[model samples]
Target: MLEVTLREYGPAVSVPLSSEVGRALAASGILQSATPDPVRDGHWLLRAGSRVGAVRTPGGPVVRVMPKTSVRRLFFLLGFSLDPARAWRDSREGTVDTGAYDDVVPALAHAVERQIDAALRQGVLQGYREVEESALVVRGRLRESEQIRRHFGRTPPVEIAYDAYTVDTAENRILRAAADRLLRLPGVPGLVRRRLAHQRVRLADALPLVRGQELPRWQPSRLNSRYQPALRLAEAVLRGASPEHRPAGSGPLAVDGFLLDMNKLFEDFVTVALREALREHGLTARLQDRHHLDTAGLVGMRPDLVVRTGDGRIPLAVVDAKYKVEKADGLLNADLYQALAYATVLGLREAHLVYAAGRQPERFHEVHGTTAGPDGRGVRLYQHSLDLSREPDQLLLALRQIAGRLAGATHDRDHEIPVR
Candidate 1:
């Protein structure tokens, strides 16, 4: 077995790799580009973008992309995005061992195992699940239509459906599925694997989910409150991994890996946090609010967020979140153009753009307009940056301040009713 390591959005590194491995990795969506080394034969140069995770190429090296942020912060973002209300409780109580700094795969496996263990401390969750089957004896209810159609008025075997109180419920199935996935992934620590196996045994009665099928959905409630944190993490594990892919003729490359796109993660965290913050000020926020740039409606756009009144009848401000750094030239032209379009379409005087605050600080660009008067007809595009490295409370506070600014925007729009 061979192994390769890289950093997210880091400089390209030359690694000894066979053509087979290089091709597999390039297509894996892990590397931004994998090119054959100009001078070194049988080697390739690989660079990663914002994606971070470990990918095991069949009969090749396991390529891992480590994140730029610390493992603890990464977990915080993931947890907060998954369930904002309960993330604080889970973070305080849950014990997640994010091993050595570079060991992301092992860290996630360990974290998941610990969460699952904590969830099952009392016992496996059981609920009434509707089951449909053909049996010799009637159960909770008889499927008259099914019996008539399948049996054609025959006796003995009967089609019936019943609600069976058992452990094979959606919540348990998700747990088992996540554990099963972790067990198959490469780089998981042995101790973590053993613990996950034990957890699987506890959930043995719960059927294994079919790969490529939609996971069973479970709603959170007081009855299963203990399982909420574990369930959220498990679902993230099951949903975040890359699907298996086999190139044109290469013998089925078994690519088993879980990756989190930092771009999408940052956007989700910012929008969700802002939405939560707005509740305090009686404002509502919509993620990916849809609108048309032109009257034809053919040119459609979805802003990352649109803050509105509590009733959602009015649009207060438009916001977009960017995960990348600011360009040397200035605010990214494309981002500025897109923000302008959002403001123009929504007919709002103010729009906001949020960026990860590493490369630049917070600022605003007042777009040029002829009627820049006291009426506030000019569109003010505010650029806010959230330092992901800041403490969780501080990060939330930044969003709260942004929420306050958004709340203030409402006053300016009090008299003006923009075209919806």
Candidate 2:
């Protein structure tokens, strides 16, 4: 058995592995391996990808990789903000010790537990639900089919359909199911498992989710707002808990792991942070806003983020977040071209592209001689770099600065007089 330790968002490490273990890791898609190591015979220079989780093989545990950053920072990067009103305190509250978790699953489970505990204190949430029941007396409406089938030889009991206000709602059911699944996972702390077990019992009346059952939709409101964070965490756990399989007979018996796409996580963090920052300036940001780039409606353009007026109809600035490390030259031309298309299609003169810190510093590119507008003015693309390695406060500060710059550019464009 080979012990492989992988860090989040860091350089790859070379692991000497037996042939059997090497095949398992490669098949799992958790590690990327190039040519074999020349210095060491039968060794592979393998690099951990963006995924942070552990994979178990038939032979044994081949590799266990964890995130380099603290759990608090990881949560922030995943678009979760600190809110004291909720029962779960921030990661600094000592509820979950930093760097104590070796895998992402337990860390996520602990976070879920904290949220659930806090939401429970306010009282179990209840909502009006339509329930069908058969009893001696009718309640609301008679179930004609059920009544006829059961009452063919008997008349004492009747089938009824009624609206009952109870805690056995779809939302609660999802939460209960999530807790149940987390309890079965290995490495969960005893305290968390006990809490989860208690929650499951409390929600015994709530129906467990069946295979292929759709998760119920919930609207944000004053009553359910408190459960939002826990609900989000539960959804993530459910998504990760589901079994995943590779092509038929390609790998060993099914392996389980939880991995979040760094690209999506980074984009979400930037978009949400920027939106919050722009709110102070009376502007709003929409993520993945769709627009038709051509008159034929065949070509569609969906920019990562679009800053707009409060009404959300007027587009002010377009920005795209890239989770890639830039080369020595600068940002990729394709990203620039994509941003330029969004700006031109949206009738804006400026666009922005945000990237993770890399070897090159931030720079701006001016594209001249464009026929996008009547005056044939060129669009200016601003490139900004955000250092993910910084602390949460520092990262947030960088986002606010970027938001200010975007707002300022939009303000100038709004007041600019056309030079005829």
Candidate 3:
């Protein structure tokens, strides 16, 4: 067995692997691995890509990789505030102790359990759900075909459908299914597993969903407000814990793990936080604004963010978030090219690129003599870096400052008159 320690979104690590294990890892495609170094005694340089999860090989030791950032921090970055009103009354406020668990699954399991327990204490959330039943007495709408098949000669029997407000609801069933899956996951601590089992038993009256069953839709309202947090957690758990199968003859094993794309996470956080900041200035931000990049409209480009006028039709500033470590020299040419394209296509004077802090400092690049704006002026690209290690308040402050800069740039561009 080989022990590999990887930092979240960090550089790759080289590990000596046997041919069988190497092939398996290659086939899994979760982690990016290079060709084995023959000179280094069959050592393969393995890199943990954007994903953070553990993959267990068939009849082999498990390869566990942990994220550098805790799951709690990730939730915060995703715009989930730790408001007491949004948390379970009996549970500790918004903070999750990720250190207590080795992997994300257990941490998530513990968090979900706390929410489920708190929601259940208020009594199983009862909702009116459409129920179809075949009984001797008619209740609502009758199914003629079903009634004929089940009770051909009987007069009292009928197949009826009605709405019933009961504990057995789609929401409860989804929670139960999530708990059941967590219980089966490997490396879930005994305590968490027991709690999950308890939750499952508590939801025994709810219908059990098959592996690939479609979950029911639930809208949050005043009545089920307390269940909102738990429902969100349950949905995330169910999505992440779903099984992914490998091709036949590759292996008989299924990989079950929870991984987040840091790139997307960073982009989303920036967009939301900036939008919040822009709201103060009487502006608004739209994420992933779709636009045709070329005249033919065949190629499409969606910038990570677009700060527009209050009406949202006029584009002011276009921004793209990049979760990458920049070279010591400067921003990557490809990033600059992409940002420039966004500026040109949007007919803006400037575009913004946000990157994760690294060795390189933030700087602005001017594409000299490139006519990008509607007035036939050159475009400017702004590069900003955000340090993810900072506290939540500090992060929001930085975003506010960035929004201020964007607003300032827009103001300057709007007031400028063409010299020509």
TM-score, per-candidate, Cα-based: 0.92, 0.77, 0.82
Among all windows of ten consecutive residues in candidate 1, which has the lowest summed lDDT?
Answer: 411-420
**Candidate 1 Cα errors over 4 Å, as ranges:** 88-102, 246-251, 358-360, 373-377, 409-420
The per-residue C-alpha lDDT of model 2 at residue 247 equals 29
Q: How far is candidate 2 from the true structure (C-alpha RMSD, Å)?
A: 5.4
lDDT (10s digit) by residue, model 3, range 250-313: 6565544555566666777787777767887888889888999789999998898999988888
**In model 2, which runs have C-alpha deviations exceeding 4 angstroms?**
1-4, 9-47, 55-63, 79-103, 133-136, 145-158, 240-253, 292-295, 359-362, 371-377, 409-420
Candidate whose lDDT is highest: 1
Stretches of candidate 3 off by over 4 Å are 1-5, 9-24, 34-45, 70-72, 78-103, 144-157, 240-245, 248-251, 359-362, 372-377, 409-420
Model 3, position 217: C-alpha lDDT score: 84
Quote model 2's TM-score.
0.77
Task: Report the alpha-carbon TM-score of model 3 versus the true structure.
Answer: 0.82
Quote the lDDT for 247 in model 3: 40
Backbone clashes for every candidate come to: 0, 0, 0
lDDT of each: 0.81, 0.70, 0.71
Task: Please estimate how well model 3 matches the true structure, expressed as its whole-model Cα lDDT.
Answer: 0.71
Error of 2 at 369 (Å): 3.6
Q: Please list the Cα RMSD from the true structure of every candidate, rounded to 1 decimal place.
A: 4.2, 5.4, 4.9
Q: Work out how many backbone clashes candidate 2 has.
A: 0
